[model samples]
Target: MGSYGKLVRDQIPEIITAEGREPITYIASRDEYHRRLREKLTEEVAEFLSADDAAALGELADVLEVVHALAMSLGIDSVALEELRQAKERERGGFTRRIVWTGNR
Candidate 1:
């Protein structure tokens, strides 16, 4: 009985029906889908940042879901995405060392 103009999982309407509710929904066109995916990513990141200790992992998982969807929208599969990530890490290293940049000379 509420209005929410945002992207959601494909199974959400089915879940709502199972819960005995009438859920209004529609499929997004390709361009709209891409735009909404970006918005969803920002929303998910905010949730992840504000999540408490007990719920942090769950929020992080949601963020990951948005990320994967965004990547796929750009025609990148998981394997290819992983390869790009690894390539970047190899070139610039990762956060393992916790290196902090100080003021330059």
Candidate 2:
């Protein structure tokens, strides 16, 4: 009977019901849904950062799922998102740099 007033994956309610538990839930308004999704992104990222390498992959998937939902919420598709990501990687490069700036260079 724990209460978690947070955004969850679409299948969560069904999973709860299948477990022989009644899941009390309601649809969020568009604005609220957007807000909750942002919160979920932050929450998932924190979880990923704290996980061990093996567990971090699963957490990373959760983070990507939130990213996909956020992109769709903003009317962008997966292909477009990936294109933007690639473009940015090409322009500014990604973590492959691993260049650590200590202090005043």
* Candidate 2 deviant stretches above 4 angstroms: 1-4, 103-105
In Å, residue 24's CA in model 1 sits off its true spot by 0.7
RMSD, candidate 2, Å: 2.6
* Model 1: pairs clashing at backbone N, Cα or C within 3 Å: none
The digit string of per-residue lDDT tens for model 2 on 24-90 reads 9899889888888999999999999999999999999999999999999999999999999999999
Model 1 lDDT, full chain set: 0.89
Worst 10 residues of 2 by lDDT: 1-10
TM-score per model over all chains: 0.92, 0.90
Tens-place lDDT digits, model 1, residues 1-105 = 113588998899999999999998888899989989888888888898999999999999999888889899999988898899999999999899999999899
Q: Model 1, poorest ten-residue lDDT window? A: 1-10
**What Cα-based lDDT does every candidate model obtain?**
0.89, 0.91
C-alpha lDDT of residue 53 in model 2: 96
